[model samples]
Target: MSDALDRRRLLGRALAFGALSVLPGCNYDNLQHPDFADRALRAMSRWNDRVQAALFDPHTLAPTFPASAITRPPRFNAFYDEAHVHVVDGASWQLELFGNIAEKRPWRLADLRAAPQESQITRLICVEGWRVIGQWGGVPLGWFLRRIGADTKARYVSFRCADGYYESIDMPSALHPQTLLALDFLGKPLTPPFGYPLRLRIPTKLGFKNPKSLVALGVTNVFPGGYWVAQGYNWFSGS
Candidate 1:
C-alpha cells in the first residue's frame, strides 16, 4: 500500500482501539495514568488529526438524506445538564463578530434572515456513539464570512457560546459549501433546546464541533482550543 494508505489504516486502528478502551468493563483506570499507553493514545490522536487535515477536500460535500430520514426532535447535548441550558432571548440576541475582520459589529437575527438561505438534510455523528439526521436551514457560512469582510487568510474560525461552550474549525472547513449558520430546523424557527436564532451546522465535523447558542465568532491565526478539546478530545474532529 502507498504511505498515505498505510497512515490511514494506522489511524483507523488507533481510533478503534481508543473507542474500545472506553467501553463497559474496560480497564480505563489503568489506562488513565500518565504512562506509555496514555501518552501513546494522545500521540495517535494528534497524528490522526494531521492525517485527516492533509486529506480534507474543501469541495467535498457530506452525504445528504431525504426528509423522511430526518430524526424527530433531534437529541439535545451540552456541557451542562438540560436544566442549566442557556435560554437566549430572540428579541435581544445579537451575533458578535471579532478578530481579523474589517467590520466588527453585533448582528441581529433579522440581518441573517435577510441573507440568501440554504437548506440541507445531513447526519450529525456524535462522539458519544449516537447519530441523528436533521433538516437545517440557514445562510451559507462562507457567504457570511465574505459579507463581513473576514480575513480569508486566517487559519481558524472560532466560536463562543452562551452556554460557555467554545469550539474552532480550520479555515478550509469554515469555507466549505455545506457549512452553515443554521437558524431553523424542521422548517420552523429553532427552539431553545435546538439553538434558537443561530447555531453552526458543519457537516464535515463531529457534532460537538457544531456549537449551539452562539454569541460571538472570531477569525484568527491563533488556535482557539475547544471545550472538549481542552478536555482531551481530538482537535480536528472531522467526521
Candidate 2:
C-alpha cells in the first residue's frame, strides 16, 4: 500500500513538472470527440509507467530471501474481478482472440491447456510493494499469440475483461519470456477469486494490469485506454 502511494506521489510530481494541467473552465470532453486533454493525459500516464521498470532491472534480482521466507499467510488486497460468476462453468467461458492476420476465434479452458505450457516459480511484486513467490502454471501467452498469428501491424495487445475492466500492453511486454495466462497455483486449480481460469501475469508490471475474468484479447496498432486510465489512473500501471 505504501509503495502504491509513493508511486502516486511520484506521478503528481511528474505531472507538475511537465506543466500538464487540466484545462481551465473549458470542458475537454465538450471540445472535441475523444478530446485533446484526454489524449494528453493518457500519453503522460504511459510515460509514467516506465518509471518502475527502469527501477528494477533483474539481469540479477535484488537480494531477497527464498519462498520459505514468506510469512505464513499472504496479504490479500482484494483486487479480484468484481463482476462475473465465481466459477465459469465451462460452457459459457470464452477467450476471444482477434488480430490482423487471422479471423476471430474463441477459446475455452481446455483449449488453453492444450497449448504449450511454461511454468515459472518467481516473484509477483504488486504495485503495493508486496512480493509473493508462487509457481505459475499455464500456457505461455506467446502460444496463443502464435496460434492467432499476431501480425506486424499489431503493436499492442489488449485484454478485455468480464469484470468491466480492461488493460493493454505493447509487444515487448506481451512477449516477455515470463508472461503467462496463469490457470493454476501451488499444484492445484486457481481458486475462484484468484482469477480462477486465467489471468495475465506480466511480472515486471504492477498487478493492476493483470486482468481477471478475461473475455477477449484484441490485437491493435493503436493504444486504447484501459479501465483505470479512463478513471483518472495511469494506464501503464507498470511497476
Candidate 3:
C-alpha cells in the first residue's frame, strides 16, 4: 500500500555504529569464523530452517503448552525505533513478498488484518531464559500464501521489521495453522511497545523468532538474516 522505506543506507550506518556501542555483554561479533564476514548474513535464515523442520516436519511440535496457563507477556526483547516515523506515524508502511510467490506484494497493515484470522493460547519461550503463556489471535499465514498462489519452489518466507530486524522461516512454518499475523493483544489493540499494528507469532520457537512491528515480507529460497543470529545467538535456536 505504501512505498518501501529505502532504509539500507541509514540502517547500514546505524549497524556500523552499533558494532562499537553494543552494550558490554553483547558479543558484537558474527560468530567470529575465519569466513565469518563473507557469509555471516545467513546465520538467522539457516537457523530458521533447522527449527522449522523440527516443528512441522510431519512430526511432533517443537513444543506445545497447556491452555490452563495464561501468558503475562515476557521481558520485552524488541529493538523498536520509536523515532522511526515511517512506522510510528503509519504514513509509510509496506509489506513485501518475493520468491516462489506468484503475486509479489506490498501490503498495508489494514490489508493484512483484513484477511482470514485465527486464535490460540500458547506458551512463548524467550532465548533470554524465560517463558510466558499468552492468548494470540490473528490471521493464519497460509491464507496469505494461498492468496499469493505460492509455488512449490517458494521455501522460505522472510520478514523485515521496522526496527531493522530480519527473520526467515521455512514454508511449513509459514503455513502452519498456528503461525499468525497478529493484530490484537489480550483482547485489546496492541500498543506500540508490543509490536503494535501487526507482528508475527511462530508458536513453536522462542519469542525472539517472532519479528515485531513488521514492515515487509520477502518470500525467497535463499536464507535471509536475523537480528540475534548476526550477534552470535544460535542460528538454529530450536532446542
Question: What's the TM-score of each model vs. the native?
Answer: 0.83, 0.71, 0.70
| Model 1 Cα lDDT, one tens digit per residue, 66-129 | 9999997678887656887789998999999999998898899999999999999999999888
- The predictions' CA RMSDs to the true structure, in order, are 8.5, 6.2, 8.6
Between candidates 1 and 2, the lDDT winner: 1
Instruction: List, residue by residue over 140-189, the lDDT tens digit for candidate 2.
Output: 77666777778734678888776566888766667666778888765566
* CA lDDT of each prediction against the hidden true structure: 0.85, 0.65, 0.65
Model 3 per-residue lDDT at 75: 43
**Model 2 lDDT, full chain set:** 0.65
Model 3 steric clash pairs: 47-235, 47-236, 71-133, 96-217, 98-219
Relative to the true structure, candidate 2 reaches a TM of: 0.71
Clashing pairs in 2: none
Pick the lDDT winner.
1
Q: What is the lDDT of candidate 1?
A: 0.85
lDDT of 3 by residue, 83-150 (tens): 55234545466677666777886777678677887777777788878787777777777787788777
